[model samples]
Target chain A: EAGVTQSPTHLIKTRGQQATLRCSPISGHTSVYWYQQALGLGLQFLLWYDEGEERNRGNFPPRFSGRQFPNYSSELNVNALELEDSALYLCASSLLPGQKNTEAFFGQGTRLTVV
Target chain B: SQQGEEDPQALSIQEGENATMNCSYKTSINNLQWYRQNSGRGLVHLILIRSNEREKHSGRLRVTLDTSKKSSSLLITASRAADTASYFCATDAGLRGYSTLTFGKGTMLLVSP
Candidate 1:
């Protein structure tokens, strides 16, 4: 079976513009998570969706938002992007926690560069 | 701020040698996991150690967790050039229903042949 997949391996956008990143989970996965790995910032959780509902979010602003679809695919939308937003946006998937297998599998990530 | 932090920030070693990296976290966690990232690519899960467990081994990797100190160590035996990557430690802060991983800045390991 295939692992998590992400689209647009690299993305470039101007400041104040909006950006969207996509991810597809493994066949039987039900949870999707978004994380931002910025320079010196490490990997910080952004948003999480389970069963198509937003379950938890990190300390980012409202501009960083995302949703999950019925098919377990997820999309992350960032509004009014800034230069600091340039980082690797990773998407991961797994069965819901407490389920059979909860170890998350990650995607190659979308490198978003805000100019 | 990140919940976990890795020390040494970077490490360099020769092939056939052993490499060790350490991670420390502030909050309590259900499990601690290590991941390897080749450059900026996706992360590959290496191992996971539960809070109740002290140590676990996989192939050439040995991981030891100390809940008392809120720290963990990862040891790679017989390092190789292919082992060069960024290693991160992640802590699962959620309880039974949900889990969110907070990762450290990671330690960059470079093993030369």
Candidate 2:
């Protein structure tokens, strides 16, 4: 089966601009997760969406948000992007939340560079 | 939120040697999972072990979990150049009804010939 797919392998934006990253979950998957991997900052959880609802989010700022469509696809929006936002954003999907008989598969990720 | 913190942020080993990475978390967890990520690529699931289980093995990968100590370790036997990557440990907090797997900073492993 095809793995999780992300669009715009790489993106460039300026400070204060808005950036949107898109992801399509594996077929039949209902949960999508967003993570950010910045230099010296490891992978940080950004948001989790399941069944078209925002299930949980990490300690990121409010400007970092995302939504899951009815078809289970997801989009992550970063408003007022800062140079700190320059990092690799990954999208993953699983059968359900947690480790309850579910394993996540990640996408190639979108590398966002903010100048 | 990130859960565990992996030790030996980076490790280098010779091919065919065994590689081990450790992780420790502060909160209680129901299960812990390990993932591998190639440079500039996405992560791939390696293995998962439940709290009640002490050890589990899959192919060349072995995982051990110690709930009392809130620590876990991943051991890759017969490592190869292709095994060079960053490994992360994710802990799933087994709350009443809501549980989520939080990942760590990860350990970068470099296997050379």
Q: lDDT winner among the candidates?
A: 1
**CA-based DockQ, model 2:** 0.47
Most accurate candidate by TM-score:
1
Candidate 2 chain B least-lDDT 10 residues: B92-101
Give candidate 1's whole-model lDDT.
0.91
For residue B52, model 2's alpha carbon misses the true position, in angstroms, by: 0.7
Per-candidate Cα lDDT values, in order, are: 0.91, 0.89
- Measured as a fraction from 0 to 1, the native contacts recovered by model 1 come to 0.60
* DockQ metric, candidate 1: 0.60
Candidate 1 lDDT, tens digit per residue, A59-82?
A: 999999988888989999999999
Candidate 1, residue A22: how far the Cα is off, in Å: 0.3
Error of 1 at A46 (Å): 0.1
Candidate 1 lDDT by residue in tens digits, B1-113: 78889987999999999999999999888888999999889999999888899999999999999999999999999999999999999888775333468899999999999
List, residue by residue over B7-78, the lDDT tens digit for candidate 2: 989999999999999999999877789999999689899998888999999999999999999999999999
Model 2 misplaced regions, further than 4 Å = A98-101, B94-99
lDDT of 1 at B48: 89
Best by DockQ: 1
Clashing pairs in 1: none
